[model samples]
Target: MAVKGLNRPVIPFMAYLLAAILLAMTPAICLIPLVDSVEVWQGLEANTRDLRAQTESGILLSMGLVDTGLKLFDNTLNHEMEEAFGPVVAEYERAEGNPGAMDLSRVREELDGRMEIYIINESGVIEYTTYLPELGYDFREIPYFYDRITEIRLGGFFSADRVVAGIPTGEFRKYAYLPSPDHRYLLELGLAPSEFHESRMALKYGDAVRELVNLNPEILKIRIFDCLGTRIVGEECPDDDRRLSLVRQAYRERTTLEVENATARELTRYLFVDLSDNDYASDMSMVVELTYTTKAAEEKVAGMFARQGGVLLFGFALIGCLCAVAMHSLIRPVRNFVEDVDLIASGDLDHPVRVGGSEELVHLGESVSAMVGSLKETIQRVRASEEAIIRHSHTLEEQVRERTADLEESNRMTTLLLDIMRHDISNANNVANLYADLLATEIEEEAEAELLRRAKAGLAKSIEIARDVNTIQHIEGGLPSPGPVDLDRIIRAEIERSPGARITYTGRPVEVLADDLLSEVFTNLIGNAVKFGGPEVGITIRVEELGEEVVVSVEDDGPGIPDAVKPRLFERLSRGTYKESGTGLGLYICRMLITRYGGEIRVEDRPEGGTAIRFSLRRAGTGGEP
Candidate 1:
């Protein structure tokens, strides 16, 4: 058994529509998470790259300062050698050919031991020196010895970092040679490291690196390593051992390497790049490693994800609301229509079904209501016919002499019922038609006026049907006798009775065989022409005598009936044209009345334009004239 009062279909329909809306929104909702993830990851990578660049720049800056210090030191050394060597060479030249004659002790004592002077012969022997450890030292088999000897021989000065036995001393030294007068011996001077901490340039370079490090907290360590893998400036980190392996890989691969510690939430990056200029080594490079905490970045990403999640949820709720509104608008009216159908099926024909929705659905409801009304009317007629049949059967069993009276009484009752039905229903229809006409006159909207016009046509049709029923009853009882009816006077009288029309007629005493109903036929035709025809319509009535019959025509400048519908114009409920509205009984009744009066009626096209309805009737003779 089905559940009562359950709107089973409505639930599923609404669900289906809502599901479709969700499906449409799914792609956008899914992309939100992916976008958030990409944004967070990109942000971290970008920060790491920027920090690595700053670290490399700091290391390069330190290398530049160290080079500047070396250049300044070399310049000072050149000046000292020129100052001391000029006097020493003067003494050695005085005692030509005597290498021992050059007293280096006096020279070293005069400079306060800041300089070292050495005397070497053409045989490549260090004959005299200020420091005793360098006495009898051989200058032969050294590139510096032969190169300096050649420079002296050429009479030009040369300076270099004086390296002994292929090992570089930490001290920087310069050499200038003075040959004896005979060019057999040379004097060389060198400068070595001393307490130069107060040098402004050197202190500036050192202080700058420290200041840079302090300014950016992200930089955990800044180291400057020379091309020979020796620390040049800056402190070496305690964690250098762990990070050194990756630093070597960065050098070997000639690229940067980054590593992150999950437990510490720290990120370390190693960059290996060449120094642009350095006095320590030619084509030199260094490794700069920077380590920073990732906690800040991670926290930022978390906050971003939280905000994005909130927005996504808000959008989801908004979409759900829109779906709900759509479902209500689309489904509520359909549900009401279904419930009304249920009520109608249960035999509640009199219950009003409030209708709304799309045009097609509204039209559907209206057709249903009309069907119910027709059914009710059919049922009432059936009941009345059954009662009449029973009464007739009972009258047949009455006394033979009173049978005629019983039959006449039955006929009278039937006639009276039809009259009451026609009178009451026709008056109601006329009142409705009058209201429809008034509404059509006042309404300015074309659509509203069209509806009113249709309503008026409907009411007019109902009235025509009632009149047709009366005519049918009269025909069944036998039509009344025809008498002399003046065609011209009847047309004039009908035209006068009908207002809101223009009728052109000339009175002519051409009498025809028609009853009092003769004027009704003319009234219907004239009214139809004025209603359907354009405003300012002109109607002409013409009557002619035909010896034994007379022909009367009513012509109007209205849209003519189509050939297709003309044959059925006189058939009950058959409208003659698409533009013709109402119960087609008007023309049908005219045809019936004409036939009853011993006359014939037909329609034709007018010669100029419009339509002509003509009918022939028997001419009224002197004997039966009215």
Candidate 2:
């Protein structure tokens, strides 16, 4: 049985497809989470930088504005005090009569509408307050102005204690002092701490910074820290301890540090540099600790990748199924064609392959069908030729048998006629002989007696004719039962029987499985050689043993057989158109009987002279066994 093509192993193709899918999805599914985590960290870092920049800008702008206002107030107060006290000191120094000419009312009235300034005497005591209604204050005991004049040599800004009249409130204040030109008085400018605080708050950009931090909270942790790394704003992070050592390290290093936690989560820590560049503030640094929990986003991205992998796997499976089906469909017809070819090769050319669907297969099927038809026709023709050969063989055999039978019957009839004629003639001759003997006994003529002897010789001729006819009948009747016969015996018998032919024999006793039939063969061959051979012709018989058979050749020195007749020399009724004369059944009968006993005969022209009749007979069984 032919093997099926479609049923061949599919593992190789399946393995290739599986390997291709695995190769395609491995990197995509495994690396997406890593990429997303990096992206989130970068986004958070950008946000933190932006917040720092905005906060720093706001702080600087606010400080600039507050310093400008304080400088203006100090300049105005110093000018008014110096103008009011310049004349008083001049008058006190140039007093001709009474040195009490320093008019305090004039000084107060002169600076009334321009300033709410305080005037203090040389003793660090407030002499008169322009904005206060209390008359004559202690001239040397108010410590705020007193401290300012004493500590600040040329009247600079200072923080001091102050009491306001209208609101009845006392609070810390910012003061600027002015010394009199004559060194007799001092003037002070005070700024409430509430006003300073209000101005500072107005300039704070914390809200904008907070908005930026809130925009992307995943990676950013905005915290305000004292110079010592204390958390002051935003989410309460762990205090700076061993656990927060990484954050501190990042701050001290002023670089971003990335670390992986126990769960394979990545953390990136960055220090928030102080947005405030205050040289006077005790806690000058504000740290914005940014802690990013990338695990969730990493998980989300990992899940997305997993889903994509599933989609890809499903797609690959679907594609694999389709490919398998397509391959099967493609190969099915070819497989079927192979099977059909196999069947045809095995001598079953009846069925043709079925072809449908694909164009190439259809064309192939047509070609194969054509080949099958041609093969069938060829087989039919071969069978017809074989049948013809069988019929011809049978016809040839029947012809040979029929001819042999006819020749035998004719030989019988000829022998019977010759016997009767010999008998009658012999009787007539005997009467003649008797009469002649009687005459011879009566008469005494010696010459007449001689004539009578000559007349008696005719009877002898008649007897010889009868014997020759009998020999012919015996030979034609297919010879007697064959026995172990020697080739020399048959050759010698033929030579002795036909004295007219110059005959020669060669070889020793070459025994054959033969009988009287061999004698007939020799007789006919020698007779033909003698009759057809010219008067000066000679005949020779050669015998040789060839394996299990004995080859005997009867050759003549007569004119060779004509080329036209040589082809049919062993055929019935086929004779050479030469001087040879005989019934044509001689060699034909010889060949038939020889062939029946597992022997063969053929005729060929001898190199030197006439035709050679060669025949082979089975050698007699060794040990006298049949």
Candidate 3:
């Protein structure tokens, strides 16, 4: 007797198939939009940056042109000024680095009040000058300026600096320097003309920033700030606290910054640009701020994303439609084929397996249909044989009764009768069991399924008993001599046959004095536990090697047998109170098999509840049991 497996929840074929398809396509559905969004963002970001770079480049280009123009003007003007001072410079050098020995009155007269000359020593201190205020002033106090003067002293070269604000006075002026032939002095000239200042302001950074803003529509406003966060370029607009803070932040971090204002639909970028020749740590870096109106670009990107989402949704819907169509063409036919096969297997002999699917499935259906037809024809032949065997059984019984005193003839007739009866019972029970198994699968209701399962189990028990009936009948003719039989092997084979029956057994390599028919004893005891205890029963098989005998016990946690039924429990046709459908031959067959093998069989109530069948066999290769 085997316990039935629990039924699983039923799922419709279409729903299962659709769910699987959706699950399989989830990554594609999610990843397509994700990849698209990344590419879109990257493209928009690249375009925005390229445009910003163009605006910055325009402003820088103007700055470059201004510097070039200033350098050219200063170079030409200083050459002429240096030539006019050539007489004064030669007179001083000839006097051996003595500014007092040279007369500058003529040079001053030649340049009118536009030019002033200063004499700097090797120590970068102004020793004498036509400008009296700077005469004793040491250029070394200003490290950046002093480094340039030191270069002129060592290299004996002349190079005019950009127009810069004069020290102490803060007045814009142009300066040029030259080293003496002996490298003991540096000659310098300063010039300040009102018309020149007016022209230079026109070519500065603020005018360049304004021109860039007017040219680039995307650039809403442009401002340049020094490291101190003071606005130094573009129109004087009211600077907010946040703007000043970000300017300083960018300068301090030496990195670029971008801020977007959603309400104003503007984006501001801060860039730090250092233009000073800072070999001596003179930092003249400015944070260039450029604001761009992003109303149009944002709108364009949003529209593109909207269109992309719409196309993706349409593709997703198309995929869903394809999945539906596939489920109809593929899964529906298979679902039908399964239902039809189940129906045919449930003993509907005349019903056809109506299937429509691939050629292989159709062929398989036809083959199964032919197999069912063959089974039906074979069953009919078996039924015919059974009837013939029954008729012969009756004739054999009648012949035995008439043969009365002839002992040999009676025994032979009884043996023939027993053999035929056992064969007939076995054939019939096998067919019944086959139908029961088929019908069990089609049953969906739990209540009905349990009943069918119990019925099938009963059929198994009946078959077991029928096969052992030969043992009981052969007792009179003389049974096979008991030999060493592997007790563990028989128990294990029966356990495998009983699926889902929870049985516990600790195995040992033990042989007992029993013939091969000993397996029926275990089959009967274990199957009896399962039949009486139902599916939740727990059974344990144990073998103990006594001094001269092996005692085997099969225990179950089923309902313990009543004391009233204990007296005749092994009698033919006896049943317990649990009363599962059976011919009561299970235990009787066990008793007969054990008795034939020189063992004793008995049943007792397990202390923990339920029944335990204990039996003792003469241990193989040993004397009889004490």
Against the true structure, candidate 2 has what lDDT? 0.58
List pairs with backbone clashes in candidate 1.
none
Model 2, span 139-174: residue lDDT tens: 234343334455443443332221122121223344
Better structure of 2 and 3 per TM-score:
3
Q: Higher lDDT: candidate 1 or 3?
A: 3
Model 3 stretches with alpha carbons more than 4 Å out? 1-37, 87-110, 121-144, 167-170, 180-184, 198-215, 224-232, 235-626
- Candidate 1 matches the true fold with a TM-score of 0.35
Question: What clash pairs does model 2 have?
Answer: 125-139, 125-140, 221-290, 272-288, 482-515, 483-514
Candidate with top TM-score is 3
Candidate 1 whole-model C-alpha lDDT, 0 to 1: 0.68
Q: Model 3, residue 373: displacement in angstroms?
A: 40
On lDDT, the leading prediction is 3
lDDT of each: 0.68, 0.58, 0.75
Off by over 4 Å in 2: 1-481, 622-625
Tens digit of per-residue lDDT, candidate 1, span 500-596:
6888887677777887788878977897787678557889888888788888889998877788978888888787545556677788889988988
lDDT of 2 at 461: 40
| Cα RMSD for candidates in order | 36.4, 47.6, 30.2
